[model samples]
Target: MYARLFPIIAVLAALLAPAAAASDLTVFAAASMREAMERIASGFEEETGTKVVFSFAGTGVLARQIEAGAPADLFVSADADWMDYVTENGSIDAASVRQVASNALVLVGASGAAALELEASKIADFLDDQRMAMADPDTVPAGRYGRTALENLGLWQSVAGRLAPMENVRIALASVARGDTPLGLVYRTDAEIEPNVAVLATFPDTSHPEIRYLAALTEGSGNPAAEPFLDYLTGPDAREILQSLGFVTDKVE
Candidate 1:
């Protein structure tokens, strides 16, 4: 009886040991950053032995969640505004804020679709009465960029009524991939990952504000591993991974 009980206790201790030593992390990132972050997080986990959990959504939604006391160790936004929103609300450590990546907006459509010139003057003719899928222009960074580009080129007023707003940029990409929408405006990185979607044209950088991605540690985070993970993001490892995923790393590029 004693020998049998010893073996049971040893098994129980072994099962509990990993749980005791594990460093659990909760990272909130923008929907567009999902794929790249997953790859980066896998590397961070392999090296640090920390289980990095993620919550991917629109920057506005994630910012609101952090502001409302969500258990997030880090926050990564697709644009500066949402990060600014959380910072002003005192939800993140302003000093830890870093711009990690950049992306361009592009016009995408179902595979095999005819290519359009991507000029604002000819954009209306390209739509052909079909609604353009995009994230909510009021809140999503990608949508805001698309809207700004259209307005800058005098195309917004003409196509305003034909916009199909999604909850996030990924959904906009999905809409085009699924052939639910004839056209979508999404980050260039998003287009790279979806095989069913064809990139028709890349919006000119001069067409809108520069797209930027920012990452920061949350104020309420007490995790010791959070700093290392955040560091890895701005470090060389993450830059390589992000660049492979079609994100522009560093400001000079």
Candidate 2:
């Protein structure tokens, strides 16, 4: 009894500008940041008149693309491992790397599902006989964190073989929202945007590595807005938008 896999979320351009101009910026970001990044990009375009072009996918996928010489002005990764992946491959400017935000891990269930504690026995009973939805624990950052959290709580065996693993966090969120699964493990911010899913249990910070989103300029990027746009992401306006969407941006860097 192993986990089942679902279709991968297609990697696609998010904010497509009419055409690439000198002032246009191209960004590669994680799928989990799609909504927040789109909002931040739109605001960046409106305020600076610099059109932003985006590609959203899993952090590992985007990191490999950048390593293979993808043309991107900036890269925002969901975790440091992938950021370190690109940095080690010289795909991004290590000097410009900075922490943008951090997030908490959570368990979610169909809307109106009663919130439950993270205790192994309680979760097992709440789930009954259904599988849980989560990102691919082997590759996706959210899944990796989720797995680690479950293991930390002594609940890994409770749902190990009963998982419906998707390619990314949003897909897992969709699974619970659509009632395709009884529960899901995703970032708190991810659970916030989907109205059909409610937080059931929260994983403590000690359960896994600190979840962080790091942003940096890609190597050899000469786009004029590349640096400024990266700076704007951690600025007051962008931070405000991110916070509104339930993201935590308390970093002083």
Query: What TM-score do all the candidates reach, one by one?
Result: 0.88, 0.90
Clashes of each: 0, 0
lDDT of 1: 0.86
Query: For residues 1-253, what per-residue lDDT tens digits would candidate 2 score against the true structure?
Result: 2223212221222222234566679898889899999999999889988889887877876776677666789999999998998898888899999998889999999889999898878887887898889998987899998999899888999889889888789999998999989889999999999999999888989999999999999997999889999899989988998888888889827
* Error in Å for residue 107 of model 2: 0.5
lDDT for model 2? 0.85
Question: What are the per-residue Cα lDDT tens digits for candidate 1 across 1-253?
Answer: 6445533543443243322223688898999999899999999999998989888888877777777677788999989998998899899999999888999988998888777785655667777778999998987898999999888877789778999999899999999999888899999999999999988988889999889999999999999999999999988889999999999987721
Candidate with maximal TM-score: 2
Measured over all alpha carbons after superposition, the RMSD of each candidate to the real structure, in angstroms, is: 11.5, 3.8
How does residue 2 of candidate 2 score in lDDT?
27
